[model samples]
Target: MCASPVKKNEPDNRKGQAGGDSGPASRSRTDRRNSQAAKPKREHVKKSARDAALSVLTGVEEAGSYSNLKLNQILREADLPRPDAALATEIVYGTIQRRNTIDYYLAKLVTKGLGKLQPWVRSLLRMSLYQLLYLERVPDHAVVSEAVNIAKRRGHQGISGMVNGVLRSAIRQRAELTLPQGMTDAERISLEHSHPEWLVRRWIKQYGAEACERICKANNEPPHVSIRANARRQHQDALLEQLRLGGFDAEPSALSPAGIVVSSGGNMALTPGFGQGDYSIQDESSMLVAEALQPEAGMTVLDCCAAPGGKTAHIAEKMDDTGTVWACDLHPHKKRLIDEQAQRLGLKSVRTLVKDARELAGEFEPASFDRILLDAPCSGFGVIRRKPDLKWGKREEDIAGIAAVQQSILEAVHGLLKPGGVLVYSTCTIERTENEDAVARFLEAHPEFVFDPIPTTGWPESAPLEQAASGMISIMPDRYGTDGFFIARIRRLA
Candidate 1:
């Protein structure tokens, strides 16, 4: 979710530097100084929240950048105040989540097709429209006026005038801009929920019309900022108490015993306990993976495809940092992320490695670990609530490609587990091919492995629901207001 900001070379506007040096380099210093005054320098104007949001939207559409990563980079570079930063974050995410519906209304308002407009101009319209339509706190006049100012600054008067007219028309015609009646169910769900049409159809076929509609609707809602308590350092109740005492609207998560859902007191990562590694920011659904694995004290485990080390840390914490957990990722830098998380959480049992899980069987001793977690690469359909860009960025074809890779890794790691050792397969995706079907196939090809029911001894009464198989659990976003996740615990019966 981070990268170093790239610096572009500034164009020198001095005499000789202008238009490839017109022999002005030979001029005297006085002449060069006089030439500099010929053209006025551009003033350094700071970006408003709207401007920042527009830039983020444009970056996502034009350069195929990840929304969260681009927003973080821009916010860091701009160094805006907390309120403005919060506003920008809201505008960016809301605009993305409702892009289809906004664009629909804009198509009716804009004489020029939405696609024909410049990327930033289109983003400006979408961002402005989102605020005008959804942001009740901000006045309509303020939204219109600010959007026009941004247009004028970034583009010509013609563009600004077009933006002004379009926004004004949209404001006047807002009530009439509802989705037309008589559309198909998939189309209605797609437009109403701002999801891609094909996805809606696929989900409807998989989960039925009612459930698909619920899933799509839930994807547009804001993701809960849940954190897992570092049980090794602080108990769940104690951590929740500390957070509440510090003015955080903290409550225990119904999903996981160690999970705490913080409604307010923004950016829990910046809190003192997070810095001290008392908890790690994670989704409640994902916190279930380590629990599914049931990592015990003095056991050796493998965390395949571990990065940013959230789940690995959870596993180590479960073991009281007593067991040796080998956390492996394909990239060296990713390994560093796990190592850093381990250090911050004071988990001494975690050993980091830059190795691919797909190649683990060849390079490592066979039947070496007590437990293995194949948190495989996936299409990430289940996480659209957090990363809305994945909706527009991914295509239907990508699912099969990702599933093939998952199959390869699953094949590689099965041999690394000792007799009666457990292997937990998990992904932040809702695709059946990569979830239930993949596990079903793995079980079919390898008869030694069997899918066991997930341990639900302490789970609430409402936790279990219908599934394609008994061992796997596919928790939809709408089910428990958690990220869409699939977890299956498989064991090799030696």
Candidate 2:
């Protein structure tokens, strides 16, 4: 276990000697052990879960890899125990989720800019600090020890020493660490809330500073599991009993009768009755869309943009799987996703289509279906909790651009709706332009189309309705403990 402290200033020596000395780097064994003790002990020679996570996080920083997908790949390949894998997953995601704040603190502690540091060193520090602050299960000594050991394996001695010094400095200043004050609102939100500066400013303008902070904070909190019970298998009461028996603390959603919330369930696919299609993993707000549609037996319904069809299957289930449910998406591969879900739930009436929703006019005559569901593509601001990267990845211009496409899709589908047939327009976003504006514009051009009220049963009594020219529902994440969503129910005049 003898080693030398590699220094950057020293010339490279092929002889593998420390500072050009042919003799041992330390005078005695006691001194060698003590010197090592002064910093951190290298516990594992090969690798640990922390080591794998550090490597993957470094890849995320350097290669711009998606955190969830990359982490999953690592978890699948690594042979670490379940607990260790879980810890690594938490470290990687926590660091990625709080990248801005972690770097801000590092910059305050270090003399050099964090961006200029080697990507590996940056990743090491971020992971270490994330565990130190957020992971109560991991002790401080273990955090420091693993970080130093990782540095030894991946970096020279000087880099390892610097990592130790920087982490120690962060620990000492944990109480005094504060974001710089007296800055722009965007900067304040970014620093205080740990969101990207660009996103903070955009949110500040879109939703004031107070509301922006609320949304940013919501994004950091761990997401909840909201399941939609498959009525085909069991009723809500029976499913709740089944979930409790399966070791999940379950409860019915206050809003949706079909919705169930689980406090903890490691892997949902492995849960009881999942293979038999007892329930499906979906958010509470999404269940609202199918409820608002109110499809009945023998009614023909079209789910525009329905791929990976949760709403489509729910619609079929609501109709007792008796009526035809045409699920359409632009991509042919996505059609299989809907078909698979339909087969799992034993819904024989659900059919999949690969045609574009805009061209439905040509494939079907006007007023062809009894009901239509247009869950348009959107910027997805409302579901930030499940997709944290959206807060940093989305741009201001992107919102308006998506809204235009949503409007065009609405125009195309309006003619296909039968007189007295309801069209439910929805998006997993909070932007007014996509929800309120799209509905407003549609009402202005088509005087025959009128707003259909969402039934009181579909929503909780606590929520207040805002009267709009074209009636729409804007469900913000803050209002309901669900992803941000907007739903508007409209009907064509007979």
Candidate 3:
């Protein structure tokens, strides 16, 4: 991820022209015109699906953009056909998902090293190799050809030559590009699983090597889409029947009572049921949070750090829409997300607020709410399957930074909970310091809060758990075939 920009590519291109220009024909009038058009601007004459994917990848690496957001923006502007959009989407996610492994392969093939290349050149090579090694549908020659053409279109012949050389070498030396010998188990796992070694090492120390490997392996998988059955519209069984009638291969989630696992039948969000608000698309792991909060009818609840309001809506459904669920996020614009979900589900009890969760105590009287759900923000290592860019974008230092934010919100909300009322702290992360330790630190700092073990009497039998350490449950991604999550229940003990 070096910051080599197009300026660097120019010098290299000039050097390339000096060395060899593909024979005397390279100096022809047409060649001169083509080279001038390919100059500084490097505007693509044609944006193929691979070009779109490459643009998305470069934007992500250079601008520090989130993969999904950047991809959505590009797709909207590109307006490529559905099939082309789908292929671009697949390549964008797949290349990011396996970036580390791709880099390892590049290390073996590239003479100049990947970092020495321009940002787009490195991304193009990585994405091309990914399609070659992982995607079976695309032919190898097409992958190489698309990459070389993109390079030539955007750069001088020399840079295109470099991309072509590396990719062709990758094709020729596929069998020889095995993981380097004698790497530690963590290194091997990191390279094979395409995860950062620091993260892999953290998992090994926290969960042991075998479980760490399993977690990394699971993170690479394409996550199944899950949706919560909108209770006001229909019962879970009723919704399953609706899905069945709609030709969806759906089943009840093993982890959450309200969840439906849609393993097939295309994008569930585009289905009529979704349009009619019969269900809301969510992950099974996140579906567990509302149930864990256990909000009763006519009770007051606060969802600190609520955005795109998934858990907030579930809380409203659990309470039968007869209670006030204050869905608060710091950003004013996100209140629209909360409102949209409430309106879609025909929920009237959700009250949207634009207030910082850390400053929520100042916004409201202390001991005012019956229940509080502080789904505090963390490193989001849990949802790597869905957002692969997180693997490359997240740094080890970021964990501590986000953990501090989690702790502040936890401390701020502790006073807002009514005496003997429940406050469930949750995060979509497996880091112990962010999960168990953060909870442990809060309990020690606040004398009024005590551990409240979530009752397992009505828990799903298929979703097993041993016991909560300090009344906190850690659901690793590998444990339940769900996004990694940690849920801890606390009560204000007067």
Candidate 4:
């Protein structure tokens, strides 16, 4: 349910056409304008209920579960009511977000390296210290006692005693602890902030240390609940009025004419319009991709890599449910996901197919469709706010690995397009290697294809492309108030 952010740099095609057979020479530029935009930065409230928070975090680590999902499940299923559930949620998410900093203090108490310790034990210490430093509402004594109690329940009494001793010692001497002097400034900051060193390094390489810190800070922030008012069912303004009447703080998104960005109200699934098919919870940035496709009433379209059918449904909705939308995915389950969504949305134009998009050209004539959308598979780096694990889980090499697949898929799918057909290449990534670099490479190899300016008929003027590229839009979280995403519009010459 996370929205992916994209960064794009379309090749400048003056003369209203894409560059001659050779793609525009390297136009990579670090766009720091949005990176420097102002916003309320994320920060911890106070330290005390740290132990209670640590208990929840420790449980997640032991189980190898999602921090938010596990905590919410525990809250919903347990006898503990709302107040305790809220407290536990705060502790778990806060600790995971600020992991490096908590560990920096813990390393002072333990003689051995934190990495060398048992997984649960390490998570236990990190959780406890996080409460002591961040949650002012919870008292230190309660934190220590609850942590010890949980430790005893989950492990031997010996482990509980160890937990109590370690937490108490850290609480007493937290002011004196310091990171190793040999560590790089970014590494030290990243550790103190509880981020993986490798992620911090990548940010530092792309942006300076100060900017990287800000980016890291943003990832820890609580996300906003936004939705694309099913314009097929209702307009954005009408949906906003309904949402306001229902007692929600919602507003029309500035970037997308069809988007209503809900600041906060309640769970999306439980929202009034959800079951009625009035709207779907999609990020403002995501709404932009479907807009880029600009599906028309009678034009045939292909949603390659379409799974869960967010864009497929949107495209069908845009076409007024008239044209054929070949909804294809590599897996049968994913194809079923598209089928289910199309059914729920009352879309009849979509045709579901469980086929590898990369190999679909053999089954169709070249340039067979008027529009094609390749919402390709990518490293989910742009959505760290919702899936925090991605920050720690992604590697630089993974980008090259994914880029290869994206390139091949794009090339394979490109051949299936009719000579005059438009193709939208998109992804939820901020990395240049996978985005602009990949798109630039695609244009280099394909001489007949031309980059087209994304038509702005239904789009707002403020959403215009900043980078010098024809038919390309790159949305970044650091810049836009939504997830990062990259999108490109290309048309084959007739």
Candidate 5:
């Protein structure tokens, strides 16, 4: 049986108001005082892991905060032990990821219907059900007990009873729970994978049903932590050896020559040589963007939409910290992030600029940069593993709107590249409309830029170089074990 994280003998923290005294007129003043003192005193309940997770979930739903950001904030404030903190993070993210499916079960068990339930109550039920359905390590009774306790403290007795009854019913009926009989293929896949039906249908249209299912499943898994070794500071081999010697399960990534996959280390910044600028934490797929640009010494590069400057710093490292790499973003606040990354990596070539990519043509001279990277903003569907809330947060219509923005940015920045220069347009999204289709539209409009094949010399030999030869690469998370990403390299022809 799983041990309950709830503390023993916790206070209920509720007080009943004084009722009118009809027959107590004869009672003595001391007797009345003694009666008042006999009532149990209300004390604040000790916070539990479930309470922290519930608070984070409610914040995400009501305040529209990002799950990762909100979860980190709550965890730090709560100062929970390691095991409890892990549980809270799991419950928060897992419930958000499996919300639709949990609601499906909840609606069946909840007689008043899930729609009528208060937002917090619905959130509580979803989190509890997520544990009952997915977290096998937690016993069902303990989940029910903890949820009931929370419902009682947060709601009235009626609400607490409702939660208890619903959870107990769910536990008893777990064997009988099933998807509706006549659900269409899209509906079935959507419910089973906890994805929006429209998104699933869109993916099916683009990638077929089997591949779409694989993509959906992959999105629910935790993302691998990979870091790129700074070539200016240390060799990849040396970094890998150093990490292993420091008791980290590190190995070279199969995708990027400069990438290292760390399996055991919790925080890469705390690892050895991190402060010395040996490496920076980045996904292998993201590292590929800088590699695709193939930056060399004495080349001017523009990284449009560079914030948190991962790829921008990588571009500078690839250039041997020589020449110039202008990193630009819309938010002035994020300029420090890019500056900090450059400082950490000891790269003096990268310069930070505060400017939107769409407005770059007005600020910079035309044909000024030898290479450009447009890591455009999109719906972020590809990184669902890292940001599971995206699965529930995004709508089908968001794709077309974001695609238009991507196209506009591409057009605005195209004139900034010098003749015979390389421009790598990439997004952490697998949607074709924002990726291949966007590139297609750009090429049709601008005749001078032509597709440039992604060089595959140092890439894994198993990579489909031929398929990616047209200067376009779409990596699926399920197939590649990396974030779903799309990259297209276009070169200007004088």
Candidate 6:
């Protein structure tokens, strides 16, 4: 649920001091000032849920803030009741996620066209239309009434009338709404699933039409909150029991052995045993990265692009906290995140460093480690269900630029791996150019490295290991019900 924006009533606590006089005249003057100050506070209107949703929509649209980050900040500050917050969140994310489809409806209804309307007005209509078309629980009249009231507060009477008329007309014409005529299958899928046309076309070329549609549909759904039990502190069964005893609706993940799926937990940090390093919040797909590496008790490993150190800590945990795992990221601020995660998981083997993966060869010796995890930075198209805004935030051209960076990091880290050392290259993306193509190119250029299939013995039986013979695996969100990820394991030949 999206949280609504709140109009803060800043109470004027500045009171005039009665200077050395307890007389009625002096006290009356102070009281008058206090009364005047209180008047302004009452005039401050508490923003309605629609108003809050509008603020967040405009913030993401105009100011270019990430929707999830912006929404969380606003919700924390507004402190709206749970129901209002839920409505606000629903409107914000639902409208944004379905922007293309909503705009299609608006284009048919608005006489002036959607582009002609003011940005806030357009957002208002989109939010209203989203509620009408998608949210079955909310009544159309109530959504229309809220939009009109928000418009009246934010604009003139004519604007209010327009919003009211447009929504009412849309409600009347709901059955007639359809996508623009004469669209190709790709174009139709793009609008129907509310994804960019270019992205849809690219996916179609790679995964075919049916699979691409499923992927797009899955991206629109809410993601599960999956966590990995820290093997160093507690077993998976122990962590599951602890969470269930604490009243969390928890279940073991069928995708990863160490994973737990919590349907109704408030916050992971607030959960019992979190302070005692019982588990780490991670995706079921992401947990496989560490498992594929198969780190031993005394091995030296490098997580080249580790941030927030989820994989690095997992590696340390698998090693029974007895190995050196150098976790490095380019951003200096992220170093603390890795350190904090290591401290939370009670793993003493992880050491955080703020060095770019592309420049790792300059700081470390050649063939320095037994295992290296290169979780390269990518376009993040695979995790769109968790962060819907990513679909709009990314551009098709950005893929090539990111792929170049991934290749460079791969080349740089290739020399750092010890002969016969295992290197698992992974990304939270399903794009072939960034995953299969990149690995293919790396293998062609570096013949000394050979494909190392991810062993199935310790892996979850359900994990797709059929492709492991090629030293790579791809998990589709729709088929797996997890974040889409690509992992390729390679080994340096002695």
Point to the candidate with the largest lDDT.
1
Higher-scoring candidate on TM-score, 2 or 4:
2
Q: At residue 1, give the lDDT of candidate 1.
A: 16
lDDT of each residue in 1-494, candidate 5, tens digit only = 22122221221111111111111001122322222122112325565889888877877776777777777667666788767876887788778877777788788899978887766778889999888878877888899999988765565567778889999998888876667777777887788878999999999999999999999989876677888888887888988898888898987887777888888576566555777788888878888898789888999999999998999999998888899999999887788889988998888998989997899999899999999999999989998887788888888888889999998899898999999999999999999999999999999999999999988777776565775687888888987688888888999997
Candidate 6 ranges with C-alpha deviation above 4 Å: 1-43, 180-182
The pairs that clash in candidate 5 are none
Per-residue lDDT tens digits for candidate 6, residues 1-494, read: 11211112211111011111111100111222312121111113576667667777877776676776666656655677766776777778778878987887788898888887766778889988888888777777899888887765566567778889999998888777766667886998888889999999999999999999999989877677788888976789998898888888899888887899988564466555767788888889999898889899999999999997889989999999987999999988788888988987778898888998999999899999999999999989888876778999999999999999999999888899999899999999999999999999999999999899886665566778687667788999997788999999999997
Error of 3 at 479 (Å): 2.2
Per-residue lDDT over 148-247 for candidate 2, one digit per residue giving the tens place of the 0 to 100 score: 8777755557767887898888778777666665788788768666777876776678789898888877776556777888887788889899878867
Which of the two, 5 or 6, has more TM-score? 5
lDDT of 3 at 432: 94
Where is model 6 poorest over a 10-residue stretch in terms of lDDT? 10-19
Q: Put the candidates in TM-score order, highest first.
A: 1, 5, 3, 6, 2, 4
Q: Note each model's CA RMSD in angstroms.
A: 9.8, 11.2, 8.8, 13.6, 9.8, 10.2
lDDT per model vs. reference: 0.81, 0.74, 0.79, 0.69, 0.80, 0.80
Predicted candidate 1 versus true structure: per-residue lDDT over 409-472, tens digit per residue: 9988899999989999999999898998999899899999998777765654556533423778
lDDT of 3 by residue, 148-209 (tens): 88776666787777778888887787767676677897897898888999999999999899
Candidate 4 lDDT over 299-412, as tens digits, reads: 899989898788888999989999799999989877887887788778899998888888899878876888889998998777776656566656767878999999989988
Error in Å for residue 408 of model 3:
1.4
Candidate 2 to truth, TM: 0.83
lDDT of 6: 0.80
- Candidate 3's C-alpha runs over 4 A off are 1-46, 468-470
